[model samples]
Structures are given as structure tokens and as C-alpha cells.
Target chain A: MSNGYVFLSIAAMAVTTYLIRMLPMAIFRKKIENRWIKSFLYYVPYVVLSAMTFPAIFTSTGSVLGAASGCAVAIMLAYFDKGLLTVAIGAAAMAFIVQFAGM
Target chain B: MNLKEVKEGIKVGIPIALGYFAVSVAFGVSSVQSGVPFWGATLISLTNLTSAGQKAGVDVMAAGGSIFLIVLTTLIINMRYFLMGVSMSQKVEEKMPMWKRLLIAFGITDEIYAMSMSRSTHLTGSYMAGLIIPPIFGWTGGTLVGSVATGFMPSILAEAMGIALYGMFIAVIVPPSRRNGNVLLGVISAVILSVAFTYAPVLQIFSEWSVIIITVLVSAFMATFFPVKEGADNE
Candidate 1:
């Protein structure tokens, strides 16, 4: 909770993220020919996004029902290929409406 | 350093900047709600343009997680950028200098990478600067606005806005999941694992590491069992 710790955490995150983005461009000139590594990297973003969204999402709003309603709206909109802004706003609006109704 | 190419890149980047503004607004609001200071949240956006990585980083930081955990979580969440960097190294013009490469590396988010790779022509420093600068402003500006706006907003509205980031995440993964069975399975597997970590008593202790663990396990399993076809669309 200290400012020092917060600064360190941010610094660590920035350095780690930058290194991941920088190292390959700085050093590697050849393509990664390894199929398995390539596939794993390809799938990582999806897996990470899924893990972060679910369960955590159910608690994002005031109540589980509100969160669920919002989540459903989001999934429905996204399933139809809605843009990120649309899906986000739709989910927030749904949650607001549900919670406002005291459901 | 063609000004014309830079202008073209900026033109192409306009939509991406708009999209990043919306998402980073969500990020700023969510991180502040989770206890990150307004300035800290903005700094995170400035330094790390990535959505998922910054989200996970803020979670760890707000939890009072150790520096090691923060670095590890960010590293794992952003490992995909390594591939992007490699792909970009090959995509940019061959004579691009080291300093330019290093500087441009800082801006290689998923969207930027995808845009650069999709181009029929080789990437240039000026074009990349044009493409990267707007999104940086959009992302950092949105965070600043959201972080400041959180103080004036009602608590209920703030809470509702928390779902915005997750909704964006869903928008990102769901389309791809619908297209690729492997991606769908990877998503489901991660969700199951994440849920188990939250609910199961023994697994509760490791919940802090759940994102990395679930990501690695599910991704590795899918890669081993159902590797994407060699020539398949990576984007």
C-alpha cells in the first residue's frame, strides 16, 4: 500500500511488458518456426482474457443478477460481432438498468 | 521518414485510436475503483498500452501483490507480444535502425501489430509513429479522464462501469472462439479452471496465480492436442 511499493509494482510491470515487446524486435530477425510455441502464443491472449473475464465478471457489479444480466447482454452483443464500445456500453447499460430496477 | 506515409498511417490509425479511447476509459475507471490512485492508473496506461496486461497488472497491484508476482503475471499475460515483436521485426523495412526499432517496440500493442502486419507494404518508422502516437494519446487521455471522472460519479454508476472492460474482453475473444474450436475449448478450459480456483478450498490458496496457471495449462494443452493449422489465419 505504500507509494514506494506501488511505484515498484508499476515499474516491474512496465519493464516486463516492455521487454516482452522489445526483445524480439531488437534481437530476433528470424521467424519462430516452432509450431507448438507459435500455437501456444497464439492462444494465450484468448485464454488470458477468458480467465480474467469469467467469475470476476460475476462480481463486477453490485449483485450477481446485475452482473449476470450485464454479462448476458455483453455476450449477446459480442456474439453478433458488435464493436468493443457497443458491447461495453451495452453491458454497462444492462447492469445499470437491472440494478436500478432493484432486481 | 516520409511525411506522406506518416499521414497515411495516422489516417489508418484514427479508428484504432477511437476504440482504444473507449476501452482505456473502462480501464481507468476500473483500476481506480480497485484502489489504484488516479495518477498510478494513468501511468499504467502511458507505459503499458496493452489492455489485458495492464488489467492483470492493476489487479495484482491492488491486491498488494509482491513485485515478483506483478512482473510474472504481466510477463505471462503479455507473452504474445514476443511473437508480435518477432513478426514485426520481419515486417518492417530492413534498413530500420536499432534506435528506431527500440523506440517503435514500445508501441506494439495487439491492434498495432495486426494493422502493421496486414499492410501489403513494408512498415516504416514514420508510418509506425503516425500509427502509434494517436492510440497512445487516446489511451492515456481516456485513462486520465476516467480516473478523474471516477471521483465525481456515483458509486453505483462506477460499479456498473466495472463490467465495461470485461465486456470488451468478451468482444475480443468470443468472435475468435466462434471461429476456432481450439480457441473455444481454451476459453472454456480457462473459465473452468478459474472458477475452480475461486471456489475449491485447496485451490483457493493459489487463486492469486490462477490467471497464469490457467492460461499456461489450457494454452499448452490446446497447442499440443489441437495445434492451429500451419497456414491458418493467425489474426
Candidate 2:
């Protein structure tokens, strides 16, 4: 990994990344006339997060038990409106302990 | 943009910052492990403000992947942010400066975007400041810690710490997943697709692409056909 090459790669990625985020807003400045499209956009986040998070939980150890322990604790905390940091650290701590005890 | 408002935004941003710190530390450690220098890790955390994009970029670089592959992977993984940015842009005052728009846009993660956009019409630059600073400190701090502690932590511990990212992610998902039947359907559908891509032959061609395209398309379609009755926007 040449320093120049890595720098250029990350820079390009950053530029493109920012552009991707900014472009849609610039284009759709006005309220979208399409209700269907609006509805779709509304629901996109829920699906996107699920798609991202589910595979992560299930695939971590090839067993849902470890993943479930973490997920259960996280869901409980989230239900109580705990902050993301608390939910994450608490569940991660539980998972760490469970995995440690197993070993 | 006043001092008081900025302080408020930062206050709201504290927990988000804390979450970002853990994730960014993982990112920094992984980047270093992949032969990326500490500066690169720090810079990436500072600039990218995206968990999936930075992580995927590092993985691609470590594997000596093509620029096209790296770009494609990140764009696909982060496409959802496009939607987020659009919605958030609406919440911002129309008279807001272009520079402010550009600067604040960099900080728009899922949580920040949700919290900020969900606000009423009373947003100010100070409010944005409050929203941005905590995560900035958390992320930068995490990278710094990871860069210094490189390799001191065991792989299992690191992997276990990674559960934090998943936990944060679950915190994000469970709310909407529980509320809307269609969102739940889209999630189940995407999971089945993801598993199929991993396990089923021939289907794997679309594995990486599946999450972005499936979620975007399915949720969009469902929203079009069956809108959430009590949408956050309507509230």
C-alpha cells in the first residue's frame, strides 16, 4: 500500500461518497409530486437498516445463540429508549462475558 | 449557529458520538491490521463519516481490489444515505448557506439524520453544531485509541467488541421493524435474499448487491403501495 496510492484512493472515495449524498438532495429540492415514490423513500431506512443488521447478527458465529444474546439485550435497552452507546456496550459486554464463560 | 444552540446540538450529539467512538475504533484497528497507516485511518474516520463505506474501502484496499470494485462496494452499501440526505435537506432552512449545507451534510448518519429531521421548523446552525460535534469527537477519539493500541487487544476481543456495532445497528432496526408490518416484511424478505446469496449457487452473483437493491426496491415498492399510516413525517 503506497502512501500516495492509499491517500488518493481514500480521497477519491470520500469525494464520491459526499457527492452521492449531496446529489439527491440537490436534484429533489422541491417536494416530490409522486406519493408512491415518497412512500418508498419513507420506508427505505427501515429496510436498509434491517438488511444491514440482520446478516451481521446471524453470521457472526454461525449460531444465533451468541447473536441472540446480544440482540436480546440490545432490543431491551432500545425499548427503554437507552442511548446507542449504552445499548451497544451493554450487549457487547454480555456477549463478551458469555463467550468468555464458554471458553 | 448561536452559542447556546450549538451547545444544545452537541448535547444531543453526545450519545451518537459515543456510539461512533466504538465503531471507529474497530475501523482504526482494522485499517492498521490491513497495513493502512495511522494517518490514513484517522483521516478516513474524520472525512468519511460513514461506517460501511470506510470499512469496505479498507477491506478493498487490503485485498488490492480495483478502484472500480472499491467504489462500487461503497456506493452500493451507502446508497441508503442518499435517501437520508434528501429527507434531511428538507428539514434545513431554505435560506441556509451553501457552505453550511455542505458542511452539515457530511455529518448525516442514520441516527443524526433521524433526530435532526424529526425536529420541528426551529432548526438553527447551533442546532446543527450540537448534532455534529459529539460524533466527531467520538469517532476521532476512537481512531486515535485504536491507532495507539494497535494489536494490543486480542482478535477474539476485537471480534467481540464488534458486537457493539451490531448492537447499535439492532438499536436502529428494531423500532421500525416492530412497528410497520411492511417494514417487517421487507426485512424478512431481504434476510432470505441475503442467506440465499451466501448459500445458494448462481444466486451469489448478486449477493453484495442484494442488500442495497433489495431493500431499496422492496421498501420503496411497499411504501408506494402501502404507506405507513402514522409516518414520522405526518407526525
Highest DockQ model number:
1
Which DockQ-derived CAPRI band holds candidate 2? acceptable
| lDDT (Cα atoms) of all candidates against the true structure | 0.90, 0.71
Best by lDDT: 1
Model 2 reproduces a share of the real contacts of 0.53
| lDDT of each residue in B97-134, candidate 2, tens digit only | 77777777777777788788767765676799888878
The positional error of residue A30 in candidate 1, measured at the CA in angstroms, is 0.9
lDDT, residue B32, model 2? 81
Candidate 2: stretches off by over 4 Å: A1-9, A24-28, A58-68, A75-82, B29-38, B52-66, B83-94, B118-121, B147-150, B220-235
Q: Each model's TM-score, in the order given?
A: 0.98, 0.80
Candidate 2 iRMSD in angstroms: 3.5
Q: Candidate 1 DockQ score?
A: 0.85
Model 2 / residue B61 / CA error / Å: 5.3
